[model samples]
Target: MDIKFESKEAERQYLKERLAAGFRIFAKYGFDEGPAGHISLRDPINPDAFWVVNPFGLHFALIKASDLILVDESGKVLEGGANRHLNLAAFMIHSAIHTARPDVNCAAHAHSLYGRTFCTLGKSLDITTQDSCAFYNDHVLYENFRGVVLDEEEGIAITQALGDKKAALLQNHGLLTTGGTVEETVFWFLSLDRCCHSQLLADAAAAGTGGATKKIGDKEAMDTWKVVGSRKGGHFAGRALFDLIEVETKGDYKN
Candidate 1:
């Protein structure tokens, strides 16, 4: 278990494979609303100014390791087939975050059903459920939704709004989650969207005059977060999902 990678090439292979797997995972969960979402990974060989992203307009379910396009901080496509092009929002927002936060190597953003609904509230998630504890005091709300994030300035604003959090709820936009690894980022995106769905249902149930929701105490929530929200926890949570997806696709995503 202590073995991380045999070499830099091995590390690169794993990261790219997981990056592709994250896309398929998102697609299976209904996170792909056309070309509205993206997952980026810091090129293991070039962690500073380069990253890998899926080609624009490609369906999440069909992406593979070889299909990812490498781009520089300035958004120029450096690799991927001749058909490769950049996703401007993916490049703008992700490049800013990758630059600002060297600690984060992976970021996943999507316009999932609940994320769209919950972000409209313009507030961070409330630690009312055990599962929501993972994000207790650990995520931010970027309430400044100035249309689509298609420019570097907008990306910078969103990054500033994110500050040092691992995830963000972009108001009127959607949810964005980042982590040190692909597994962690994908897991947070999955957990966050589900949490948003839970909140929506809970809100409907408590909409009456006297139906109030119970929230977890600060100490309790923080304690639970230590177990469920850690980087290692998220990675472990992804193992089952990844294993299943690989089997379902017959290891096609690893290509």
Candidate 2:
């Protein structure tokens, strides 16, 4: 069947649904807390604009597709029923990525426990398992911790640190992932979160009874990416994930 969004309302609704899906998945994996953390998508036709972040202070479990605020690449609100202002750090962090990397249509960042733990250690996420392997040689490390990213300058610094990597571990902050599309970015974050969790578990096990060291070979890193990139899902999968999330959340992202 051919699905077409023939009207602006339809397109807005479609985008809203996709945004809602991102929220649900993040919530499902416990990547959010209170109002912290955010996910954003670039406007498909314009490189200088993007969807506004869902207002800060909302529960991830309650977000809906329609509650997403529309914003320009400069973080100015364009549409949606959300509160006028967004979280300062999110605007600084997300807007920078959107502006600097036109290739990245979707960007997500969160203070998930595992990701936060790894970020605090000042260590990169080593490619130890298949899950973490997708990020092998593909993550950037941002060591500048300038408190909360509250301005365009900090945002620019974050973007510079992101460079060409699809993922970045913000020192003393959290994890960030970007992609050519929302699906890809969301999946990257999901995978990154899992990878961090796995490493933590392994670390715990190693220190459990005896001082056993967990080591992953160089070849294992290459092997991990091989397994991950083998399958290409494209746009359909991202839209599907969004639609599924819309159904699950019942379109309740406001409050």
Candidate 3:
């Protein structure tokens, strides 16, 4: 869909609102994980900078458009207040991604329960279900884990590992997903977590039965991805989720 804005401010507002909504929806679904996760969007007016959630203390559910912090490429807070700080790990990871991939307008990283568990196996999601097919040949597995990602070198390594992929499973860590829009990126994060949950359940069942689960062929999986993994599909899914959250929270996030 072609999004037309009356002015630059309107576009910036649209981006801010969506970024806030993404945080709230992630919190609603238990993706917050004790201030460990972050969702970031490229600044609408300044492509070299991005906006991210405040560091380490604020609850994701309570985040509003006005609560977001705008940061430059060097991880310096430019627009948000002095009390608001950006997480070093968030800066290391997201900055690398936004710098490396100009096409990625938004990047989401979270230590979700199932996603973390699935990452321990050092494997990508298999095409066991149609939903899993969304990641078929589209995700990467970052097999190296060098403790906490505090250094720029670690972040650059991750960026190289995630080259041109939509999602990445960080070994012994968690999941990272990127997209052209906040809605699409958030939806992919949600979908990836669900796929991880489904895969774990399937593996347990197959282990008990001593039988292998059926798999979809590469061609079929790729074809299904075209329909289910498109940015348009993700945007629609995210909008549906945002609508539900708006009703549940009574649009409090807009404040």
Candidate 4:
């Protein structure tokens, strides 16, 4: 299939809206902490580039649709429309994923509380509930904590760790999720965070007992996926996230 590039004006507008939608979703779910997480969309024209990412120091709740800073796959800032510096880790992580996975059009990374907790344990979430079933057959665990990823090679390693999985837990760090659309990618991130949160709550309720370790039957997991994943091929969940964000944030994701 041939990929088409949007007009410069259209690309900028589409990216602005999609990015704002992502930031709003993150904020609505309390996934961001003082600009600690990032999301990016692949440029419609450039296979080797993506739109401007959430810049360094911009709080998720306060990010505007027009504040995005365009960056290349090589981590160079092509346009800082908002006069902000790009987050190094955003470039490192997102650029690597976009380069390695041409099929993924959007990527999200965050250090949400529960996601970090699960990642620190280096364990994949079992298909223990409907919420966790989304990743029942696909997910990865990258346990090598190589400090902060300050270079492109580390980013490449992170992408390699992700492999074909839609989600990956960055050990000692947090979580990363990708998708064919910005909406899908944001939905996956939200699901991962919620799943981690649900698991944590279950563990707390179990009082550290084995109740937390109980796994959903494989058949049931498959059934749950059929219900959730097959719902317009996840377009429902993705759009729902977008709508929820708009409602929660008073229709103002762009500040």
Candidate 5:
């Protein structure tokens, strides 16, 4: 179950700690490719106006709650990072996502190894397993790569492609996942990469067998999705991941 905060201050602190913990968890999974990945959370007090992100070029493994910076939609640093530089791509992409989807409060994107490899296929994940069913009809493919995402136009285009989906595969790029909470977003991203890894392995084995991969029927996938794909189901799974990370890191992610 989700914890309830007595005040906005307490809620803000929780968000920061979870956001930083997310980075640490990603680092443990070898998801950090220099500064190529970013995960952000909308500030509890300023949900539409401001969000928290890591300083540009900082290693995700070394991220701490004190290292997060608050930025507005215009990319202005509001607090906590006067000396640190904001990742402009974060501003362009997250700002657009936060604006486009009021329900999404946290977003995670990374150039994870398997995610990029699977993105080359330019298709959604095949739901042949119970875990993959969580994203059965809840993901999309962003076919337009358009080089690096530096401009506002590119960010908006990506968000438009995302629509109401929980995850997206950026062709020739990587994976992007969004959720109402940091835990859910991180869980989806991690799970997405694992699914991609499984698919890649299956494809390789199938190539040798001269057979094609079998897909689960849509009706069954949809039925399983209702149980595992809902926000509540995601939160239930994400809570376990957050707990494991906290134990592994000795709770040092908290400031």
Candidate 6:
């Protein structure tokens, strides 16, 4: 499972492939809500800029490595043709995080059904299951919800709320996750969305039973997180998903 690159070009190609795989995988899991979701990977050669899918009418499932567009921190398209345009919200949210956190090479956000539903509750996930334990103390809940985030100031506020956390559940919005690699970031996004779904189900069942749900203690939850919440763990999960999607899609995303 070691990733050894002989050259920068090799690394860039790997990043691009993984990025495209991420989009396709997201689409597979119903993460694409129209053109609302975005995943951005920082360029290996240029840290100030990132590669993202172009804002065309293409669905995420149809996105390929060639469909990606390179954009600078100022939201200017640097590689894609004249027809390509960057999503303003995507640029605002992703650029703010990339600029504020150099260690974050990738950031992902989406209006996933479960994630969006959980955001409306205005509460962080409780440690109800081992999967939910991954975010026991590692996630935050952003309380601000001022409509669609079209302004840089709102983006900066979201960035501030996400400080030092692996995932943030934006109130009335959706989920955002960051990582040192695109693989890790994608895995976190998937994991957090599932956690939201699990929590909602648990809460509903508890209410039906007229009983309270039990949670893992902080010490135990933290220990569990050490195993499942690590970047290496996330990368492994991402690899598994990528392999599954590759077979299902016949590797079309690599085109």
Question: What lDDT does the true structure give each of the candidates?
Answer: 0.87, 0.75, 0.88, 0.78, 0.87, 0.89
lDDT of 1 by residue, 1-255 (tens): 144898988987777888888899998999999988999988878776555556678899998998888888878787764567778888899999999999888988999999999999988898899999999988999888888888889999988888888899999999999998888888899999999999988888888655978899999999999999888898888778888898898889888
TM-score of each: 0.95, 0.86, 0.96, 0.88, 0.96, 0.96
**lDDT, candidate 6, 97-177, per-residue tens:** 999998899999999999999999999988889988778778899998998889999999999999988899999999999
lDDT of 2 by residue, 214-239 (tens): 55687877776666732243333355
Error of 5 at 24 (Å): 0.7
- Using lDDT as the yardstick, the better of models 3 and 5 is 3
The C-alpha local distance difference test score for the whole of candidate 6 amounts to 0.89
Candidate 2 deviant stretches above 4 angstroms:
1-9, 209-214, 229-247, 250-255
Clashing pairs in 6: none
Deviating ranges (above 4 Å) for candidate 1: 1-4
Which residue segments of model 3 deviate by more than 4 Å? Answer: none
User: Lowest summed-lDDT stretch of 10 residues in model 5?
Assistant: 48-57
Backbone steric clashes in candidate 2, count: 3
Error of 3 at 237 (Å): 1.9
- Kindly indicate the candidate among 2 and 6 with the higher TM-score: 6
Report the number of clashing residue pairs per model. Answer: 0, 3, 0, 2, 0, 0
Which tens-of-lDDT digit does each residue in 13-119 have in candidate 5? 88899999889888989899877889989898987655555667778777788889888788878888545687877778889999899999899999999999999
Q: 178-209 in candidate 3: lDDT tens per residue? A: 99998889899999999999989999999999
